[model samples]
Target chain A: MQRLVVLPTSRTGWALTIAFVAVVVAGIWPVIDLVNRAVLFLGLPLLVVWSYVLIFACFAVMLIANRVIEWQEGEDD
Target chain B: MTSPWPLLITLTYVAIAMVIGLRARGGRRMNSLEEWGVAGRSMGPVTLYLLIAAGSVSAYTFMGAPGWAYAKGVAVFYVAVYLAYLALVAWYFGPKVWQFGEQFGHVTQASAIADRYQSPALGALAALVMSIGSIAYAVLQTVGSAYILFVMSGGMIPVWLGVPLVLGCIAIYLFVSGQRAIGRTNAFQGVLMLIVAWAVGMWALHNATGGLRFGPLFERLLAEHGEFLTLPGAGGDMTFSFWTTSIIVSMFSFMPPVWTQWMSASSARTIRRSATWLPTYYVVILPMVVVGFIGIFSLPDLARADTVVLEYAMQHLPVVLVGLLGAGTLAASMSSSEPFIHSVALSWSRDVLQPLLGLSDALTGRLARWMIVPLMALVIAPLAIAEPGSLVMILLVGLGFATQVLPAFIGMFFWPRASRLGVMAGIVAGFLVTVAFTTLWPHPLGVHAGFWGLMLNLPVFVAVSLVTAPADSEVVERFFRIAAPRGLTRLGSGGKTVAADTAAHGG
Candidate 1:
């Protein structure tokens, strides 16, 4: 039986794959260092706010990139 | 001091939903299974957004999130963490799924994967797994709705009656109107539930704490019961690892059924636009979280943390408002249950039945409606017999099905050489690993088993895909021709054939 596959073949795809993996790893790494006390003055609110902004920005960039790629493809057509 | 007005108002809401469903049945132009199951695959952004929000933010969010916050303190904020991640997933995958759905005329996630991988067996397996998980999910909603009714009626309504009643409504609506009814009712329920949630949240917080300020309450909790506020507190409460893992799990869990919804969107642009703004629902949930926080300070000693929101509303809010809150909770459960019922039916009829029986889309859509009765009975009967578990735990278990979809769905977009062999291997491996981790292990390094399973699944997906020979180039090219960036700019040359088939088949 012939196998069927679906996905894009492009640098953008590879980049996204790498970035997603990196974020998953980095986001969870802090859970391992249980006893290490880092004295930071930043409050939970600031951290929460910062994380939201960061995540939103990441997705915004991804959406924009996809849009640009589509636009470029339209131009090529 | 008793009043029947609250019960009257809630009955009115239920009647309105049923009326909407009946009206929607008149507009049925369902010539195909996709049109029946996914609203003819023609939902606009607003409708799609409402459908998604209504389908996702279930009774769990109405009661469970706040209840969790009340019990676990700040750690409950992880719910928001997952909601944000869910939006990201939707934003990334939504348009692509829509494009593929449009091309293949796909109705279910399994059909999409099966088509992409050229494996009917894989599709059957996916449909089976999804059905099992979705039925479990439906039961959870049944339990939630029953619990709300039981509580609201002050135990006048028995669990058996309530469970069947709620499931009956879902079955009737799903049978009568299909996805059109689901979308319309979801839109109405979504608005009512949101308003009720916001009103109850704001009113409860204002009345309990005398203002929106939670600073004093937080400080008090810290002083007296600091353990509840922090992870793995002195009392062996939730740990930081647990909190982090739960966040990750919740974020990723939005993939499975939601992907089906994305595929059902009317257009790629609708999917894109919906993804962009859907996170606002998460933003609206802040008030619910605040209500939970307020509950901690006001009713710190309350038992059964899942009842925190309801208990607070009962104790503090006026009678009419309490009924509204009860209706809102019911709406949350019904909104999710209705769409899920339709999706489950679609999965069975499209992925399992059509392939097995060689039935046309019209036959399948009719079969799907017939399937809803047995499905609802299956879910509600068990819920009535068995006691409900922790809402979060139940939610997580239901969400485990979603994790299984990650490798195949994500690989479709990002990994070009992802073969059917690899996708199948990944799915089987993911399922086994998730089940083993969940059942056999107490805790894998103090993290949820789903996280461990996901960790295992990703590597299996990559390793198998890389080691296996690539799929046929023609198939790959066709997929890209329909789904890639360039594909988005121009309609497929094969569009004529699909349109012809749709017209012939009554899509």
Candidate 2:
């Protein structure tokens, strides 16, 4: 029952899920509706900057996930 | 090629990369298919990162992306966004692939996918679909590289000669050393493109705006052309739904080159480490697209949007820097093209021809090696010469079909309920729907045909699986067991394992 927690077991899984949602949100409805405008930020368009931020966010997440992921050998009979 | 300076840089870049390729030509004799196809699975983290990074960026980034920025404005940011997600995809799936690759001798994506489902026929189908998609990409590379050579040479190098010249060189090196050559050459090209991409972008930005700072530049552009900085861009060419879905579809688009590079890594950790850094690789797209934004203000009347980078660099930078930029574009294009050609040839020989015709291992390897020349000349050369569409458009069309495989790939790792028959039906239906949507009647409410296809694909996949018999329990067990994430452990298949594999192919 304890193992049934909704949280991802590994950092990699969390990054994978979050990055997936981030991409769709940045690229799709509901979320995209907010960012898809004519404003400028940080010397770039607000929308373009949004994409850059997402890329960096994914990068940051994977950096954390990579630290946690490890390889183990299968059992020997 | 009147501009000997750029032509010289291009030539020098070519010579250095050729030397790297020749040096990577594997030892003594051309040996096992593993050595040829996956570099004997001996790539370290740095080598794999460079190879994957180079494989991702192409003439499209140097030329087409800026053109999209120049012509369509903010729409080009789709390129950068999708790539970041691609890195995350690689990190999550790559280790599992590396695990499976070790336990089984799977050298191609189709082989691995087919093995998971315990279906050779499914593998063959995947091989066939991916071959078409990969060849379409190879064609884009051929056309894109030829365009660079032609333009840089000041019309001295014609498209006819340029296509074969670039293709011939790549074919020979790939033939000689296979994936080893690609890894070595990619490392050289990848570093050059990243540095040159930023330099050219900064120069263009500064030249156009009087400074490299983007806030002022965007502010100015907002004053002059407010619409260019927002969705649907300048002329409202790409709408909100189209742009968003394009990013989503392109992000998930299946590429065998990525998997090929992943399988070659020494361990799953090597892949995870490499994937961690891959998002930074999108740095190339940022500057290249900035160059595009610069072109909008500086050289707004260019005949072809695809020539935005070339035209902008010529106007702003010195001859030497322009030449260097030209060299980088060509090097980037050539570096990116070879892997697709190699992957296509691999899937054809290992996954399709071997299984379809029942060819022996030795025979398939020999046949695959010989197949590259005709495959390029007869199939890809015509399209390269035709210059059928913009690099991004042709690339997207290919991606539409490639994205059809996403359900299958996702089901491989996550969904135990996914049956081979169910997945296969979904793929076929999705492929057909995508083709019809892209060709027969496009702009289905401005949602990319691929996204719409996915809409139809998911239900069929789930519905059919609900009714179909599950895969054999033993096969299913092996699939999940091998793919399950685990802590650091000993390598399984090497009999005398010592931390898995890596030292490159001889050199």
Candidate 3:
């Protein structure tokens, strides 16, 4: 019988997943707690900037990580 | 007394599209299926970026976005938020698919899946599902274009005239130049639509509140229709549940026939690089939100919420701008429809016909090209007769298909042990659960049924894969080596030599 083994998560992966979850929670907490206030003072502009920045950062990180992994792998090969 | 200028401009655009398609025949020798289907996989970064962006933003962006905003206030921002994540997901998943496509000479997503899994049946099933979903999506685009024409002509142009005319143009272009036609037309439409959207938005904002700033407009909207601007209060339609479901639906926006454009990228890096800038295209939709905001304050008593953008443009903007807006909306509809027509054709020809009949690539490609006209007729004819539901509902149904495919995609990427059985079970179970929840009740708890289905699908997929023995080790390793290759440039090169060497003597 083949042994069932769980793969270890990489540090970068763990950190990224945690950071993404944290940002989402932080963003949503205020929306839940202060609905109207959030819309007026924080939500609109925050959402607009968040839409652009977060998406850009996410793609940037993925691209960078892929490139780094590929570079390292190439060196090893 | 309708002006002929708008019709003239639109006709000119169509004429130009046809000219590009017909003119493309002279430049290149079409020897192989690749040239016919994927433009020899020769797209550069800029064309790739524009094509991918235009493929994703459709009539949904032009009319549906502002319509949703007019109907559902701040909740519509979820669409933008979803688009952001969709690009990110594409950034991650797209490269691997592109790598596989390059290595195996894959022409469609199903081709890659079938090749990796060694299952023709799975590939055929995927093709069937995507084809049905794409036709539904194409029909929606056709209907949207017709609706726009109906609005622009002030009912002079029949709905029947709108669908056939627009679809006829799309069919002719797609049949003539294939991906080349789509790429050039998309780039043209993408730029013009962005300019026109910005112009209409600025003009609407200026006319409504005397400037582009949102301060005055926001205050006015709050004073006039406070509830519309915020989440629904008790007993209102925009409950916590609806908001959560909307978010979930938004997440699956990236996984459709439209995303087939990502699969056809010239290289993995091209796909990755394009993902970075595609979200910036979402800025084009910000104008729609502005238009919706104007609608709320300016025309509070309008009966149908979906007409807010068009109605506002008609009343407030100059006639020339209105004409431009009409052209822009038509561009949005056609931009989406043509690619979808091409994708559905590819799905049928490459995925279903070739596998089932063992036809040559050339024969299949010819069949695919011929298939577009009939498929266009099939979609447009029905949509003209019976107007489909709201664009949001149509979009959600499309997302449901994506959700069904998500488990399979996730398994293929991250979980090497995930068997075909596991994948199939997860898809079937997830799809049924989503349908049951979405239809039987207002999605269990607050979340969208699709999200819950996805949430359930992952675990079932994992458990089933675990229960089943892992797939052949060589196959799994080959997928990993291709997906996360040791040498990036070597990723798509066939691993036949490696597999053979390993087979002769164990690695």
Candidate 4:
């Protein structure tokens, strides 16, 4: 997990990019409309709930990427 | 007549911010342009986070988010995803910038590009684009502060007066302390805005619904005003593609202020850690969204959707709380606006003027910076005062143009083959195309203008670069050395398989 810092590296970057594209696709259009058609979860629309989920996923990924940077900085010493 | 309580609270916040600004300077001699412009590159994570978040969030969250929510419904959530992506963009790009700045003494974004591509013209071009965006954004903040003042003062202070008054205060602190004042003040404002945003969001929920939970209330909105809960909301304006593009455009806008903040950090890890904690601040403004939703039912006939947050604050919270929260909201806008104003000043002085005049002296740099602080504020104040109907559109166009610069950074760090000629051509072409898409033809195929511009820009940039000369090998190596992956491979160039890496960094 920590090794993934400096995510601009082609391999890790590709994976993150794919994940983000997937997230973007899932959040927009046809799919979001599909979620909108569903029943509310905890009183919020499924689409809104889904956006939070995707955003959280972004946070989780960023956290790992951050750790990677920190871990590598330590290695530089 | 204006209420004394709200005025008092706002004044207290301002007074505290002023003291913080003064203290931030702390006897440090700002001997060079770098020190004044980037806080001498020594900000910790906490100060950096506050500065970045306060600079970015601004009137957009406390006021505009609720305004969008009140007017358009689910369409407003575009703020959420784009902001998250912006953090991601910052996280990915910021550290590399810090490394370059540390190694190269680069203060302005244009300086980095000029150094990297060995083209002073390219750097000047970047400074030009960023100045336009920063000035427009500062105007938006001015308008936002005017509205907040109008609400807090019970309409005693008008927009024309409000614009100069707020900008005047910002100009003073900024001229005196530069980035240190801005960073320290942001720490106070950031925490205050967060606490207040949540409080107001929850209060709006309770005041409107007779309860704290918004899930049930929102479901009714879905049941009754279903259009509000879906795309092309309320007015049928927000298309799926538009929503996605707005977020994408925002993520890639690459404002100069963010560049200054990123370069100002003490370490790359500070940037990463600050960026990591950034998303949690999302919850801070969730209530503003809820306030907008409340406006959908409670204040149905209000003329301006942007006034929703203020209306809710006045109607729901007590006078004292309104005073306190209003101070926070106004503080948020003011904090964010200062950076925009400051960036414009920095770019105009350090990037544009110095290059044009060929000044290398530290005293000259500081003088140029000081001159622009008041000059830029005065230039933009009237426009904010005029309160043109096209302010939002102008801001959008500015941001669209800002997006044109993204390819340069991408080319510099990731694509070794990206030539200066190609970038300059792409920027010109992209700006022209964005203008066409935004004004002449709004949202081609329901996609936002900025995205349409990029759709054209990226291909042109790549095609031209492939044919033209590449940047100096040594310059490319220096950028890549810092941004390079573990084995000194340039960004997005590690481990073969060019196609995959190319797609990953394309954003």
Best by TM-score: 4
User: On residues B6-122, what C-alpha lDDT tens digit does candidate 2 reach at each position?
Assistant: 777877887788788978975734445788888888899999999998988888899888888888888788878777778878887888888888888888899988887888888
* Candidate 1 residue lDDT tens string, B230-341: 4453336556677677767766664446767787687777876776666566655656766777777677788777788877777888988888887888888888877677
Fnat of all models, as shown:
0.05, 0.55, 0.09, 0.31
Expressed as tens digits, the lDDT of each residue in B106-186 for candidate 4 is 888888988888988889888887777688788888888877787777788878778777877777778777889899999
What is the C-alpha lDDT profile of model 4 across A1-77, one tens digit per residue? 00112334446656767765676676667676677653577788666777788778777878876665567669788
Q: Residue B131 CA error for candidate 4 (Å)?
A: 1.0
**Model 2, range A1-77, lDDT digits (tens) per residue?**
00111223345555656755665475566676688778866667878878878887877877765544432122221
Interface DockQ of each model: 0.16, 0.36, 0.23, 0.30
What are the per-residue Cα lDDT tens digits for candidate 3 across B1-507? 177666666667778867876565456644345765677776767787778777778887777778777777766665676666666667767777766666668767777667666788887887777665576777787887887777777778788888888887777767777888888888888888899999999889889878877667766666666665555521256565566556555665444454467656778778777876777777888887789877876787888777788889877777778778888888888888777778777878888888899999778878888888777777556664477565445445456756777656654565555777777778777877776776677466667777777877878877787787555666666666655443111123332223322321233
Which CAPRI level is candidate 4? acceptable
Candidate 3 vs candidate 4, lDDT winner: 4
The per-residue C-alpha lDDT of model 2 at residue B271 equals 89
What order do you get sorting by TM-score, best first?
Answer: 4, 2, 3, 1
Q: Predict model 3's lDDT versus the native.
A: 0.68
Worst 10 residues of 1 chain B by lDDT: B496-505
Off by over 4 Å in 2: A1-27, A70-77, B26-28, B388-397, B485-507
The list of candidate 3 runs beyond 4 A from truth reads A1-77, B21-26, B29-33, B232-235, B239-245, B253-259, B388-395, B486-507
Range of the 10 consecutive residues with the lowest summed lDDT in candidate 4 chain B: B498-507
- Residue B45 lDDT in model 4? 93
* Per-residue error (Å), model 1, residue B368: 0.9
